[model samples]
Target: MTPPSRPKLSLRASLFGRFSLADTGHDLRPLPQQPKGPISMVMRLGAMGVLLGRTTRLVFSARTDKGDTLRLAHKFANGSAVFIVVAMSFVGMIMVYQSTVQLNRAVGDTQLVGAAFLKLLVRVLGPTVIGMLIACRIGAGIAAEIAAMAVTDQLDALRLCAADPIEVLMVPRLRAGIIAALSLVIIGSCASALAGMTTGVVLFSMSPSTFWNFELIDNADLVQGIAKAFVYGVTVPIVAGAVGLSARGGAAGVGRATTDAVVGCSFAIVVLDSLISLMSHVVAGL
Candidate 1:
């Protein structure tokens, strides 16, 4: 049996869509039109802009709830622990193996393998690769969570209660994102470096002494890697929250917002990585 087709207009929507009757009983009324395509896109973008601006303000505001933020941070940390460990371990191994193979093929000696891999992994790949993974998983969750809240009028109720959703919701996610991103990158970077060094020792016949001499990571690299982690941490949840809060169209809207959160956060992480690398180079040169 075919499922009944859902009415285009709810009782409320039908009431809202009603117009004055024409003289003829046979007069046909057109369906109420929803905003289509580009207009909807533009409106969504504008809404995201406003939401992000508010979220950023909330992140730095003294009035935002600290206890709630901390609670959220703790929750995300505990929840994501296994995922972080497994994902980073595999990513680290892959990064090391891939970099080693490419460099060794080109240089023959593979002596610079550790140095090259460390340079790229610490400053760029660590946060970004990890962030892309988070954007797909955690980011989508954040978006859906907020979007569900918005669709259910929970966000509206919060506003009516004189509570700021930005503080209670987005700020905590931002904190969680930073904590998660940084933790993952550090764990992943160490794992990757170890994998690279081990590969150099076992596969490339590189002596442990020589591998150590190549200098897997330096103080500057450590600092830069942490900075990248912080940046990615800040980026993902804010984007997710913005998309989520702006969502319309109920579950379908939440789904779109979730998808956008994934794609937007991934793209943002890659773009930010490039920008940060360039800025770091400029600063280092100066």
Candidate 2:
């Protein structure tokens, strides 16, 4: 029998198959065209509005979510900080008294040290009150807001909607944090000054008028403290929000996020404070 004729391969068919293959060397399909309509524009605006609304809602909710945890933390931190301040102030008062007592004795100026003590007390108390108020108001708010958003799936929704979540979520928090930090620092500084001055007068017998007159606080020192507080403020909220957004597992996740926020913020504050101190010294030397 004659050998069966080999099935002829159609060149055109082979070429077509090659071209149509999913792993083809080249894809010939045209790129999709952009939408060109008022409706598209409106949709884009709507998405933007949603992002804005969510961010605003979170911020507003943060203010309302102030809780006992925050209050307790504030009281604890403030009391501890105040105690430390008092101890340091006492040391400073002793030094000031030692330094000025001889001058007073020599000049018959018994009120000099008393005035200085009063001023120091005022400074300390002012800053302490301010710090406590801020820690309670802003710290707790951040923790609650971030934890709530995480639990609500708002962050995931933002990702699905192709939104730049960082800009939408973090920017506002950063702005708020800076403002809160500055306000707190100012208040804290005032409290510390007042407390120090008071302690000086009551315990050390320093002169109030002379203490106020002495320019012990430099502009640079004040600026450094404010800058440190502002840095802390910005970092704390962002970190808390990030932690909350990334939380997994349900109520447990929220708890983790809140705990992380508080611990992380506190740690960051300490680190930033050290760096600021170094920078301040360098700048002052210059």
Candidate 3:
């Protein structure tokens, strides 16, 4: 005998059943709650303590590193800075003499020519001294520090310790760089101005008052130049530090990082200077 006929399924019911099964299969399970035990609590506390300690150490290390870098840079390069300043001063003197002589021939005023030469000399000296000082001191130090850090794997260790390496290391260096740059600009400008005045009086026979008469020698230009230097200082150290921190392999990596830091910083300085100059012109126009 034939078995009792099975109930025929409608298309809509079949579709519904299939969808229901799929929905049930795809439903997500609730996440398990973490066990609340004494051991777990202790572990959590220990982790927090380690985090706090690392943060404290990072802050302290940044400050100490910045101070040490600045000191070393100044100590090692002081003599070189002085020599550069002297050489630039002499060059300024020669340039001024030539400029003044040409002007004198054109205008038939030898006295005014000598006065112009003195003014030019003073203006050129200050900037020259500042540039050389920064180049020899801050520039080299940044390169070396980044290279050493790369060589030592200090940066990698920082990452392993869960530190934001850039904030800890780069920010302080950037701040120090700004300070150094501004100091160099101010000191260099004064040195150059004095040298120019001296050359005018001794070599070109110009009066001190006449040499200092130009309004361009005042705070406006000096401030603009210092601002440019400040940008350079901040950028150089940061780029150097970043390069060093990202270095890999071994000695070869350190060498590459060091070279990249120097070349990159120098190029950055020139680009920043140009941008600042353009901005200054725009501001003046406004």
Q: Which segments of candidate 3 are over 4 A away from where they belong?
A: 1-84, 108-133, 160-163
Q: Write the per-residue lDDT of candidate 2 for residues 1-286, one digit (tens) a residue.
A: 9998754433222222211111122332222442347854443334323333444445544332234334433543454444444544555545455646676569867555544443433333333334334444455556666567656766547556765454455555655555655555554444444555565577556666645654555565455555555556556555555455445557776777677666655555556556766776687761
> What's the CA error at residue 129 for candidate 2, in Å?
10
lDDT of 3 by residue, 86-167 (tens): 6656655665566666766798554554344434333333443454446545655666675677568675576567655554
Q: Which scores higher on TM-score, 2 or 3?
A: 3
Where is model 3 poorest over a 10-residue stretch in terms of lDDT? 15-24
Candidate 1, residues 1-286, lDDT tens digits: the string is 9997754543222221221011112212334564668865564455455555656676777376677667766766666666765676666567666766887678756666667666777777777787787788778889999889877878768766877677777777887778877777777666666766776677767776666553656777778778878987887887788777756678898999899999988988888888877887898841
Ranked by lDDT, the better of candidates 1 and 2 is: 1
Q: How much is 173 displaced in model 2, in angstroms?
A: 1.5
TM-score, each model?
Answer: 0.76, 0.52, 0.62
Backbone clash total for model 3 is 5
| Candidate 2 weakest ten by summed lDDT | 15-24
Q: Quote model 2's TM-score.
A: 0.52
Please report the candidate that would top TM-score against the real structure: 1
